[model samples]
Target: MKTTLSKIVLLSLWAATTSLFADSHGDHDWKPLFNGKTLAGWGVVQGYANYYVEDGAILGRTAEGSPNTFLTTYEKYGDFELKFEVKVDEGLNSGVQIRSHSRDFGSRR
Candidate 1:
C-alpha cells in the first residue's frame, strides 16, 4: 500500500508539472495584421482622420474640424486575440476596437 500511494503521488506531480508548462507556453497560432510597410488590409471610415504608414508603424492624426474617424479592418472577425503598441502625446486619447461594425446613417443633422 505504501509503494502504491507513492507511485500515485508521483504520477500526480508529473501531470501537474506538465500541465503548468503546457499552459505557460501555449499553442499560439498568431498572424500579423499589419505588413509593417503599408496599410494594405485596412480601410478608413468617416474621412475625418488621416492614417498612414511611417517607419513601419501605422499613424493616425486627428484633423481639426473632422468628426470621430476610424481606421478599421476590412474583414470581420467573430473571436480573436490582438496585441498592439501605441505611443501618443500627452492628453491624446486612443484605443483599439474589436468585434465592431459600422453603418451609414445618411447626413448628420
Candidate 2:
C-alpha cells in the first residue's frame, strides 16, 4: 500500500509540472518589430533628425534647426505591448507615441 501511494504522488507531481510548462509555452507568441539590421518597416516624419542602425541597435540623433522628429511604425495596431531599451543623452527629452494620427491635406474637399 505504501509503494502504491508513493507512485501515485509521483505521477501527480509529474503531470502538474508538465501542465505548467505547457501553459508557459503557450503564453509566448512575441513578434519582433525591429530587424536589428535596418529600418524596414519604420518611418520618420517632419524633421531633420536622423535614425540608423549600429551595433545591433536603432540610434537616433537630434539635428540642429529641425522640428520634432517622429519615428513611427507603418502598421496600425489597436492594442499591444512594447518593450525596448533606450539610452539617451542627459538634458534631452524622448518619448514614444501610440495610436497617433496625421492630418491629410488632400482630404480637404
Candidate 3:
C-alpha cells in the first residue's frame, strides 16, 4: 500500500554526511540532496506514514489503519542519475517514485 509514481527520473540519495555539498572525490558534479541530519526540504503531500531522521538516515514508519503515505521534495527534479541505499523490513514495501501528478493523491480510507 505504498504510494509512489511511475514515470519520472530524479535524484534521491541519503548519506551519513551532515551537509549538502559538491563531491570532493573527483566527480564534483555530484550533488547531495540531503544534509543527512533532518528533513528540512521535504514534505508529506499525502497519507499518514511517519517520516523522521535518526542515525543520519530517513525512516518511514507506517501507522495501523492509515493509508499509503508519500514524502517528496519541495522542488521538482527530472532526468538525473539516482543512487541510494535502502533496507526494507519484512512486510514493508518502499520505492522511489519516478513520476507523479495531482490526480495521484487520496484513496478510500
Candidate 1 per-residue lDDT over residues 16-85, each given as its tens digit: 3233333334664444556667777777776556566655555565566767666666765544443333
- CA deviation > 4 Å runs, candidate 3: 1-28, 103-109
Model 3: per-residue Cα lDDT over 1-106, one tens digit each: 3312111111223532223353546665655556667888777656776677766666666667776567776666654554445444345555667666544433
What local lDDT does model 2 show for residue 2?
Answer: 27
- Lowest-sum lDDT 10-residue window in model 3: 3-12
**Could you estimate the TM-score for every candidate?**
0.59, 0.61, 0.61
lDDT of each: 0.51, 0.52, 0.53
Q: How accurate is candidate 3 locally (lDDT)?
A: 0.53
Kindly provide the TM-score of model 3 when superposed on the true structure, using C-alpha atoms. 0.61
Ranking by lDDT: 3, 2, 1
Tens-digit lDDT track of model 2 for 1-109? 3223323332333333233334335565445556657878777777756666655556666666777666665766544554333334444555656687765311111
User: Model 2 Cα displacement at 99 (Å)?
Assistant: 1.0
